[model samples]
Target chain A: MSNEQDSVSDILEDNTYKYGFTTDVESETFAKGLNEDVIRAISKKKEEPQFMLDFRLKAFAKWKTMKEPEWPNVHYPKIDFQNISYYSAPKQKKKLQSLDEVDPEVMRTFEKLGIPLDEQKKLANVAVDAVFDSVSVATTHKKKLMEVGIIFCPISEALKEYPELVEEYLGTVVPVGDNYYAALNSAVFTDGSFVYIPPDTISPMEISTYFRINTEETGQFERTLIICAENSYVSYLEGCTAPQFDTNQLHAAVVELVTMENAEIKYSTVQNWYAGDKETGKGGIYNFVTKRGKCQGDNSKISWTQVETGSAITWKYPSCILQGDNTTGEFYSVALTNGHMQADTGTKMIHLGKNTRSSIISKGISADYSSNSYRGQVKVGKNASNARNYSQCDSMLVGDKCSAHTFPYIETANSSVQVEHEAATSKISEEQLFYFESRGISRENAIEAVISGFCKEVFKQLPMEFAVEAQKLLTLKLEDSVG
Target chain B: MLEIKDLHAGFDGNEIVKGISLTINKGEIHAVMGPNGSGKSTLAKILSGHPSYEATSGEILFEGKNLLEMEAEKRSLAGIFMGFQYPVEVPGVNNAEFLRMAHNARRVSAGEEEIDPLDFDDLLSEKMKTLGMEKKYKERNLNDGFSGGEKKKNEILQMAILEPKLSILDETDSGLDIDALRVVAEGVNKLRTENNALILITHYQRLLDYIKPDFVHVLSNGKIVKSGDKALALELESQGYDWVTTAN
Candidate 1:
């Protein structure tokens, strides 16, 4: 078994990053660098409304006063903001009427990514909005979604077709001054998915988006906002990957979800960014994202489930703000880091209303020169009487060379509130490996089975198809680790 | 069914099994009895292709093939089964699922169709019944929180599921209570067939009273000092291991 594991590691060490190829689709790319003028150019290029331009200006001005945060447990070379192109778009000559009108090269890339854009074979009950680089290339199942009074489309298109709706809810949850990365995303985010489930109606299909960063020397900043009206329910999923490069690419995304009275929102992410070469860590994606959902009305619920396996350096925290009485919030995550990858991720649950409840389950796996950290906080305000929170963070270290850390903060002002936190760290025991191998399971399969067991709780929270995909994605990322 | 030729196995740098020769025919139960550190367990581990315990020299023949050349998983598919004394807990792997996978892996190797989950669950429940196990044991993580007796019973269940040609039980009776010992022995008794063989490595003659070995071998200082029929086990139990060690 040990010999089998060593051979796998050797093969992975000599292999290249699988998703590191370029797609030659003609795109309208902007000049590199950022400034007030560049921000204005992006706003004009999108043909934005005056209020939209004002929103960008306010976020850009706030972003200038902020410093890059260094408190996360991940380490990376300083990002030169001046070196990155702020905006890049796949140039479509005209409005595409159908899937065939889209660029075939980019379409083929999606096929390789296992996202069959063809409507007939598209994942059942899923409405997809494919975003390439800085713009949404196609939106599928739009008519069906529209018929049910649900609005699902690119945020770019939403700003034009329904500016009043976009203007009312854009920054209501995550304002421009939320964080360093959130401010930058609000200022320059080119495109992402927008979902609105109307009051009293459950969305017939899950809303999904496939985000790809194609152009080199460019930064991708996408903003996603999902609003569930009073007494409604919705499920949203986002998957991301980027072409590998020798230089680290910047990806700062902001996702905000708002649920009203008796409404529920389920959001999931499978992040598979390019994690540079195994040796030297010369290139990869610098993923610094801020995701937060607000349970604003009584009896509302918001749940976040993420499977993060890529990114050379990841510093993201998907959080929830319980602001209404009897609101419920949950965060389930599985973050795997291998081969020089570093991730600092978890979630925050803040309770401000009476009887609010939250639960967080995080599983972190580190293998082969990787470092994974889980940092989270749960706070109950003075008025939040009887608020409850339960948090569990389990870390699995695959090899001796990797590292895992956990940090938890809990604050309660009301004595009536309850908070329970449990954490455990373990190594993949040699005994377990030998046991599986002796039972006729190959070493690779043994490792995969162990990991899948470790992350089962989090995977159960994802949609059925995505749960399987997340498992397969985790196996692909941790294929090289062993005893 | 199995042959070991002057086996010279060791761990790290120290030689544990200096040199030993053994053979067993189908339908036979051979008891390898020894005091602590007599290399009985190490011999069982080596037969199952343990990564540690290098076979410094000598050869092992399973049926007609060189068993030493096969990987651990391949040897398992080749009908070798080892019941561990202290089976490690795999916290998230479902017990029934693990059994089905091992069963299918062997079936696939022999060009047989894999059993479906429904059929597997029914078959597993029937086997668990034979071992006096609850149906809920199938839903649990493999031996994650099992009692000592339960872990040993799980090994028996695995052996029953695989129905291997050769089985080496390494001190399986160490932690069993009287009741569990009876159940486990009964389970093993049901698995014996003319085409299969069993090697029971034990510290006492108590287990042989239930399962009944065809031959008894006394091991001292990594070598088999005496080989006899079942009567020798009762004699060793009454005389104590000191007599055997001193005699060698």
Candidate 2:
């Protein structure tokens, strides 16, 4: 290795995860184990109907028989599923009458996390559902949405008031038997945002959710579902932050989206979970999430954009089921793992209808001793004649100790399928750093600029409010990788 | 403007520069002509505080401050700029954004306000016009796929925008044709004032034909062995370095 690379590697080794502070609020924490009784208690605690209870029971049974997946290019000690607590909700959580009724403490925490609760204080026209611990504390712009025949509320509330919509769409894109983590999420998901845009009416505001995992020794299982009727359009974004802790916390979330004919949905997330410390890799969130969207009708569209910079270990593949003719799907993601963080994330596109199209652009960055990988698959069904899929996955490494890997799979049963795959792996050259530094740019800023440039394409796809946020987050996460 | 005393440096543990020392003055242009592997590039890299070139024994004073004690960027902020021979290709970084950021960095260090994007565009356009660069170059990635001549022109353009007091051009004329060399030299010449100095490191005297140098120094093996007027560069261009290296 070059002398410069050696020093950069040393510099990267000294960085610690910054957003690791635990809130002292009391939570109705569950017992540190998983079972039928535990699952039933969670369902009952949420006041879910019998069908939801039965669904949880069946999912729990299925989860019990399934084994943990180990195919991802990541390494961690085996997760003790039974030892993990299934739920933890803030004790003060209750049906909030208004945003003013939200606990002042929760409001303060969100403010410190850079999430604004006051509607007028928001930088963009986004309606946020702030989820603290295991419950949604406040959801903004609900009355205005209701005026437009739009349904935007907590999924738990939707399950109670709009049970049919919840039942018909929940687990439809990502079934309970989808994977081990998805099955577990289906059984014990506490609360998440729900959105239903009525036909032919565009959402007046960008819907969003801000999830904060505050307590220790608890797992967060949130199930989010979005349904858009014909000719409707909605753009949604989600952000997450967690405090530092010594013990690893489990976060298994399931998000599903359904769009009808001519409907469009744009979903984005900027996740900065508390990665473990720098030395021993202790006290980080283990984020295993299952997110998928389905184009259920002709000419429908769905786009997923995410910037993941945190989590000790992340295994997620936000996918698209292109089931409608002439429908289009997109996945644009930038996943950066610094310190000892490990992330194996990408997306899957399943083309099932004639003339369907999908595009994937994923960028991964690894710094310090972290390992980041991109595992993606593109599939074309036999009847999906003239289907087109294009994917490009790139990885960037900052230090000599880090590693980047890319694994892409393409399976086409039809002969007319048009699929393109492009992949590359690179390291920040010392010459590049020197070139910037020689012009009065600090080493950290130079590194940040290079990375921001690498992720320009994906960042432009994010909501205007979050494109700048994602850029700043990437700089903070990789600042230590340069001297 | 700058003083270097007994500078000895190299990569890893081997000393590529063995006790080479020289002093530079404001308003003066010093051309250090040398062959390949004569430690010319090493000197430039060391002056820029590149992590690779370790200075074992040296004292470089820039405006009465110990230049070696500062980091690379601090040295830059203190008015030292290196016009790289082979400019690094940053693929996705836009040229206009990169120049604006560099401009803003100096401004911020001087406690001046940052230029807004709209105003920065005007300033960048003005500079590009002065350098005879195309408007589309602003949108292109920073030297990513630029030709050799274009890359050299970019270095000079950066030097013009940064307006450093001490500029070191390391073989900035190596790959340029006559017209590009003249354009690049004109940009450097336009930026030079009585308060600034220039160090042009080159192998051939072709660039010196355009950008006149006040003093010419011959560096071989590691240290400067000959110091003369611009006539020395003209002599070396015809007779080559043996006339100097063998003379010593």
Model 2 lDDT per residue over A1-483, tens place = 144465566655655455566667767888889888988898888899898999898898999899999898888888888787778876763566666766677777887877778766653577889898788888878888999999999999998999998988888898888899999999888999999999998999899999999877778889899999999999999989888888898999999999999999999999989988866787789999999999999999999999999999999999899999999999999999887899999999999999999999999988888999899999999999999998999998887988898889999999999999998877777678888988998777787789889998899998776898788788867766643
Docking class of 2: medium
Name the top lDDT candidate: 1
DockQ, all candidates in order = 0.63, 0.56
TM-score of chain B of 2: 0.97
In order, candidate lDDTs are 0.89, 0.88
Q: Write the per-residue lDDT of candidate 1 for residues B97-146, one digit (tens) a residue.
A: 88998898888888999998899888998888877778778889899989
Please give the range of 10 consecutive residues that has the lowest summed lDDT in model 2 chain A.
A1-10
lDDT of 2: 0.88
List the lowest-lDDT window of 10 residues for candidate 2 chain B: B66-75
TM-score of candidate 1 chain B vs. the reference = 0.97
lDDT of 1 by residue, A82-184 (tens): 9999888877767788888888898888888878787776767888899998999888899999998999999989999989989999998899988899999
lDDT for A207 (candidate 1): 90
**Residue pairs with backbone overlap in model 1:** A20-A244
